[model samples]
Target: MLLKIDVASTVPLYQQIHDQIILGLASGQLQPDEALPAVRQLADELAVNMLTVAKGYNLLKAEGYLISDRRQGTRVAANFQADAVFMQALQEQLHQLTAAAKIRGLDVKDVQELVAAQYQSFEGE
Candidate 1:
């Protein structure tokens, strides 16, 4: 997986890594059960601290998006399901985004179209 980190962005490095991995999974660029680089290896490649990469990996593991074993290393979780906690979080995020769009005077149809485009991009992946 190629993860692009915007060092100049206000977003935290770990969060960027976490989000990119999620996008990769959604776009099917990263496949189920695919082994990810070791934390240290990824850190070195991304020129970030190992702890940052580890933190991202740990968060994904806790969210059931990844699994790690001493013998097998870390791999994308296969047959992952969106549990209730994840669904609630997703709804909250959508709520915030919708509010932001409204505040910016974006029409509902515009927002819906943007959403549809993104949703369709993930299709047949």
Candidate 2:
């Protein structure tokens, strides 16, 4: 997967990496059981610190989006389920985003359309 990191953005490098990987999975650019580069290798390719890559990988592993073993190195988890904890967090985030959209003068239909467009983009990918 190709990760594009914006050095000028306020977001941290590791977060960019983490978010991009998730996007890749959502877009089908990454598949279940797909192997990922080693920490050192990805760090070198991204011209970032190895620790940064490891931190992102570790977070994904902890979140059950990835798995690591000596035999397979690091690979996408073969199965991932959105448990209640994740669902709650997602609902909270959506609530915040919807509130922000309302404050910005976006009607419900506008927000729904925007959401549909984004969802369709993922589907097309």
Candidate 3:
């Protein structure tokens, strides 16, 4: 899998990395049991601090998206319960979207249609 980082954005580098990793897993770009780049290796490759990559991996581990050990280094969590992960992420996005839509006078039907249309673009990808 390829990981990209943009430094100028308001989001922290580590957060951006972590979010993309989660997105990758959700989209099945990275399979369960896939090995992740070591913190030092990724940091060197990305030209970012090692601590940043470590922080991202730590957060993923804490969230059960990654399992790390000294010998294995780090790998995607073996628990491939896609339904739970995808739905949880979807629900979190919905919560944020709902708050924004409320301020803009949009409702559930509008959000539902928007999501359905967007998801259609991902069919069989």
On TM-score, the stronger of 2 and 3 is: 2
Query: If ranked by lDDT, best first, what sequence of candidates would result?
Result: 1, 2, 3
TM-score of each: 0.94, 0.94, 0.83
Best by lDDT: 1
Candidate 2 segments whose C-alpha is farther than 4 A from its true place: none
Worst 10 residues of 2 by lDDT: 80-89
**Clashing residue pairs, candidate 3?**
none
Judge candidate 3 at residue 12 and give its lDDT.
Answer: 94
Candidate 1 lDDT tens digits, 1-125: 79999999999999999999999999999999999999999999999999999999999999999999999999999978878999999999999999999999999999999999999989967
Instruction: State model 3's lDDT.
Output: 0.88
CA-lDDT, candidates in order: 0.96, 0.94, 0.88
lDDT of 2 by residue, 8-67 (tens): 999999999999999999999999999999999999999999999999999999888999
Between prediction 2 and prediction 3, the one with superior lDDT is 2
lDDT of candidate model 2 versus the reference: 0.94
What candidate 1 gets wrong by more than 4 Å, as runs, is none
User: Candidate 3 on 1-125: residue-level lDDT in tens?
Assistant: 78899998899999988999988886779889999999999999999999999999998887889998889989999895647877898789889988999899988899888888767655655
Clash counts per candidate, in order, are 0, 0, 0
lDDT of 1 at 62: 93
Question: How displaced is residue 98 in candidate 1, in Å?
Answer: 0.6
